[model samples]
Target chain A: MDLAILGAGAVGRSVADLADDYGHRVVALADSTHAAVAEEGIEADAALGRKEAGDPLGSHEPEAVFDAPYDALVEATPTTLGDAEPGFSHVERALADDRHVVLANKGPVAERYDELRELEAASAGSVRFEATVGGAIPVLSTIEDCTPESVTAVRGVLNGTANFILTRMAAEGLDYDHVLAEAQDLGVAEADPTFDVDGTDAALKFVILANVLGGGGFSLADATVDGIQDVPGSALELASEDGRTIRLIGEATREGVRVGPRLVPENGALAVTGTRNIVQIETREAGSLHNSGRGAGGPETATAVLADVGRLD
Target chain B: MDLAILGAGAVGRSVADLADDYGHRVVALADSTHAAVAEEGIEADAALGRKEAGDPLGSHEPEAVFDAPYDALVEATPTTLGDAEPGFSHVERALADDRHVVLANKGPVAERYDELRELEAASAGSVRFEATVGGAIPVLSTIEDCTPESVTAVRGVLNGTANFILTRMAAEGLDYDHVLAEAQDLGVAEADPTFDVDGTDAALKFVILANVLGGGGFSLADATVDGIQDVPGSALELASEDGRTIRLIGEATREGVRVGPRLVPENGALAVTGTRNIVQIETREAGSLHNSGRGAGGPETATAVLADVGRLD
Candidate 1:
């Protein structure tokens, strides 16, 4: 299999490394500055070295990279759903050439799920974004494999950094500010964690899933957006005293969409704490499937992208 | 799609109901006693009536049901492994007839995975059993999606009843006898819970997974099996005091298989309390996908069967 990754960030490099290790020809790797085209598989270690060295991407060029001959595209660019000039141009180019997409970035789907659906349908069932929601959770494929018609709801913690912070606050009586600072220091939280802290990241994910479940376009604005920013310290303490924990729960029901911080039973699956992001999907046939793991991070998201590509190819 | 549900047990009846609701014609439903053939589609509500009226099978004769035409066969009899018995016979007949199979019983695979694999291969890619473990958890399907290569290891709490008893004993500081009696009375444990408490049930599940992951055959004896029966009360208490829980974990590795009781951190994904079952699969590409959900009981298992039939059809 010939693969091209349209980003040199953590997720993109991880996918390249795994694919190259498994003997797949990683033909191209790209970043905002430039892109590298290699018919004889890109060296993942070298790509990492280039990033660490902070060398200008003079030897690489984006136009040639996008024009490279590859069977699939692993899109791991930084999320651009909330912005205009996102990575969709590169993805659109790849899809137009009939290259199947395994996406971790929430840009294309969250911004335009319906248009992408049309593109996928036109291409004969080739595009998948299993990594957009739960890292390596498999919730997307599970819902797709089960009853497609009766998926009445998708709910649970969809953001890892926020959930990790909330878990710390709820369990150890730590302030949210302290936990957020620690998470950023550890690289779990981005320097500007607005999307995750304000629930926009989860809303983007919910939009993608709601489209898949309903087979129709859903606007992020239609969701009842709330975030962990306003969850009171007293509420967390009360929940802890009651043997429960507060998790930033995102849910979509027939009644409508609901996202925010909420109290869950201490022993519930969502309380599988730490950096794990757990999700609970309620379907008509499969009542509820809960998945938990390293819900966020470069390695986990990259693994999901590789799985999606491997499954399709 | 036409569905032929063999065995009117909890799972089969549930599948028939769901398929019929989805406009798939359930042409046949059979039991050990008799069979029901309805070409136009059986009324699920009426079927339930007959089942509850001491005729749990609903006025169906076995011969007539088997003779009916159908597109897919859902074999969901009670699990009795390693025997050329009813479940295997049903699957064999389905395979011989060139019908797709969505199996929910372990007997067919446990007794004859190779023979069944050959039969399926002969007929082409038409048979699947995603509902075999972690009811509605999608562990098998996720692993299949994760990689085309063989899986390296699969470990989890496969048997919900054993885990439930162990969890209850640990939480309530009760003896084995007390917990067993409570579990049986609550209908979580079988009246004769040998298959669950003796590790035989988990071993059977691991054998099936090993076959899928390794493309080879294995027996129950090949697994290093242990159960929660010997968990000393003091040990569980000590683990609990240290914020951990005792779980009966079954693991399949390249070296061998291990099924025994182990201590997991209280907040660990596998430490999911109550009836929830969690599975961790280590694969070549996707490092680990942790699946957790309700693993036992009638509704969860029935939903699993429905999910399998829904996908296969």
Candidate 2:
């Protein structure tokens, strides 16, 4: 497969770097301002190195990628909320050209699924965004394999930042503020962790899941979300006394999506620690199935995007 | 799709009973001695009702199902080891006639995957055995989606009976024998639970997984097996003091397959309790993925078989 990757961030760069290993060629690579477009394969390592050295990927304008010979357009731009501008528009252009779009971006998928699916219906191209939720966990594919309606619910600790904070709070018996600061110091939490700590991040993933399960009628606003911002160490201590611990759990049934700090059995599958993420899928006949893994990382997220490309092939 | 389901046990009955809901017709349903064959689709409920009443399913002989018109043959017959007899021959017959085979039996898959694949390669029909591993957890599909080469290993508590006994021993601080007796009383373990307790059951599943991941050269003999019989309650207590517990864990990699009692983090995802089964697929890029659910049950296993049938469609 030939690939045209948009965005020169960690995930996009990883996708380009690893595309060859997955038996694909990078026809075009871009990072907003400039693009390295070639009918033949582009040198991913050279382009990435140039970007790392604070230079243009190539002399070509970023728009040149649309004309480049490619089979799939990888959407790895930063996630944006509400209108989900650039990502949605990028997807639009890719599908309009009859090229498959594999997304590592959550914005277009979570916020604009209905419009995106509508656009896809009119185009020869199809859209797949396995990396949107739970990073590389293959959550969406599992539901797809089970057939969407057969799976009744998807619930999990999706936000690595919130989970890290909660897990540390429970393990160290430290207050949320202390752990959040430590997490920030360790690069586990961003300096301004509002989106993650306030449940918006996890809510976005679950909302996307609800969209898939309910067939594209959901967004972040449809969710009832609560994060780990106010979960005190005392609550963890209390739950611990009863052989339970509080984790920021996100659940998405067709009816609704919810994310909040809930008490789970201490030794239960849902109570995963550290930055690990897990999703529990409840099926009518299969009971509950769980998929846990690294929810976010460059190479990890790229594997999901590549997997999507493979499926398109 | 029209299905011919052999073995009128729980899984077979559930498949026939639920095929209509899945938009499939059951053309033939059979037990060892009785058969109900109808090209226009059998009355599942009526056939099952007759089965429950200890009467023949119909006047037709079991061999008559082989002549029935069907899209797929669901092999739910009892699993036999070594040559994996009737089950293997049943699958052989299905594929020989160019009919797809969705298996609930583990014998052929775990013991004769190479020969089975060879048969599939030469036949128009294909073979799928998701129910042979972790029941309805979608373990096989997850590996397939990730591409087996990308999955490094598969490891988990794949057996429900062993897990139930171990969980009981830990929770009640009772000896293995005591827990086993109680489990038998509660019907969690069979009266002759040797297959489960001695790790043969879990080993079969892991061997099948190894076959899938490694491309078909494994059997029960290749696995290094161990069980929970020697795991005393004192050991569980000791592990609990260190925030750990023992579970009968099975792991399958390209290199080998192993099933043994091992210590896992008490609150880890692998330490799922009760009869719930979880399989962790270690991938090259996705990190560790876990799928947990009712690994055994009529409707649950039936869902997997039916899902495979849907895939064939």
Candidate 3:
């Protein structure tokens, strides 16, 4: 497969670096402004080195990547809300060109799914976003294999930042601010951790899950979300006493999506510690299936994008 | 797809009972001795009712199912080791007839995987055994989606009986024998609990996983097996004291398969309670992915078999 990766972030660069290992070639690599396009294959190291040195990846503009001959366009740009612009437009441009799309960006899938599906239906290409939910844990693909109709619901701890804070607070008997600061210090939580800590990130993932289950007609605005911002140390201590712990869990069914700090069994599968994330998929026939792992990371998310790419044709 | 189910067990009967719900037809149903065949569709309830009443499922001989018109042969018979007979021959017959095979039986998949693959390679039909490893958990399909080549290792607690016993022992400070007896009384463990408690059952499942990961060449004999029978209640107490618990954990890599009582964090994903099962798939690029759910049940396993049938073009 020939990949045109749009974004020079960790996931995009990793995809460029490892595409060859997966028997794929990167034909185009782009950031916000500059792009490096090669018919055979891009000099990935040089482009990435230039990216590291704070210069243009190549002489071409980012839009030039669309002209490159590529089998799939990997959308790894930073996610945006509502209109899901740039990412949504990138997908629109890819599908318009009859090129398959593999998304590492969550915005289009979460906030503009029906439009995305409409675009997919009109185009010869298909859109896949396994990286948009649960990182490389294969949540969407698992639901796909079981057929989304048979899946009753999906629930889990999807935000590693919030989960890290909650897990640390419970283990160390610290308050939210203290743990959040500690997580920031460890680089586990972003400098601006609004989305991760405020439930928008997890909600977006669950909204995507809801769309997959219900088949379009879902977006972030429909979800009911509650973050762990106010979950105090005493709350964790109380939950611990009751053999439970509070996790910022998200649940998505066909009818709705909800993300909140919920109590889960302390020694149960849902109370995963540290930066780990777990997704519990409830099926009509198979009961509940829980998939857990690192739900965030450049390489981890890149593997999911490549896996989605592998699925296309 | 028209199904010819060759077993009157819980899984087979449930497959027949629910085939209509999944938009499929059961044209033939059989046990070890009797068969029911109808080109249109069999009265599944009648055949199952007869079996429940301590009578033959049908009037025809079991071999007659082979002559029935069906798209797939569902092997839901009891799992047997060594030659994996009857089931192995049945699968061979189906593949020879260019009919897809969905297996609930672990024998052919775990012990005779090479022969099964050889038969599949020569025939137009494809063999899928999703129910063989994790019952309804979608373990094999997840690995298939991830591409087994990229999956480095698979680890988890696979046997429900063993897990139930271990959980009760830890919770109630009960000995292995007491828990085993309780499990048998509760119908969680079979009358002959040797396989479940001695790790033979979990080993069979892991051997099947190894075959999937390595593309054949594994059996129960290739695995290092240890059961929970010798794991005293004192061991559970000690593990609990350290915020850990003993589980009948199995790990399957391309190199080998191992199943034994191992300590996992008390609140870890692997410490699933009661009769639940979990599988941790370690991918080279994606890190570890854990899937937990009901490992065994009639309807649950039937869902997996039907899901496999759904995948057969």
Over B120-142, each residue of candidate 3 has an lDDT whose tens digit, in order, gives 99999999999888877878877
Fnat measured on candidate 1: 0.55
Q: Tell me the lDDT of model 3 at B156.
A: 96
**Alpha-carbon lDDT, every model:** 0.76, 0.90, 0.91
Where model 2 places Cα greater than 4 Å from the true spot, the runs are: none
Against the hidden true structure, what lDDT does model 3 obtain? 0.91
Per-model TM-score (chain A alone): 0.93, 0.98, 0.99
On lDDT, the candidate that comes out on top is: 3
Candidate 1, position B58, lDDT: 53
TM-score of each: 0.86, 0.93, 0.94
Q: Candidate 1, clashing residue pairs?
A: B34-B60, B34-B61, B34-B62, B35-B60, B35-B61, B35-B62
RMSD to the native, candidate 2?
2.3
Query: On a 0 to 100 scale, what is the lDDT of residue B233 in model 2?
Result: 85
User: Chain B, model 2, TM-score against the native?
Assistant: 0.98
Say which prediction, candidate 1 or candidate 2, comes out ahead on DockQ.
2
Question: Which regions of candidate 1 fall more than 4 Å away from where they truly are?
Answer: A20-27, A36-71, A82-85, A89-99, A122-125, A168-178, A228-239, A310-313, B21-23, B38-69, B148-152, B171-174, B229-242, B265-267, B282-288, B309-313
Tens digit of per-residue lDDT, candidate 2, span B1-313: 9999999998998999888878899999999998999999998889889878988898799989999998899999988999999999999998999989999999999999999999999889989898888888878887876779889998999899999999988998999898899989998899999999999999999999999898989999999999888887889999999999999999999998999999998877788889999988888877887778889999989988888887774
Candidate 3 residue-wise lDDT, A1-313, digit = tens: 9999999998999899878877899999999989999999999999999988998898899999999999899999999999998999999999999999999999999999999999999999999999999887879877876678889999899999999999999999988998889999999999999999999999999999999999988898999999889888999999999999999999999999999999998877788889999898898877888888889998889888888887787
**Candidate 2's error at A137, in angstroms?**
1.5
Candidate 3 fnat reads 0.75
For model 2 the local lDDT of residue A82 reads 96
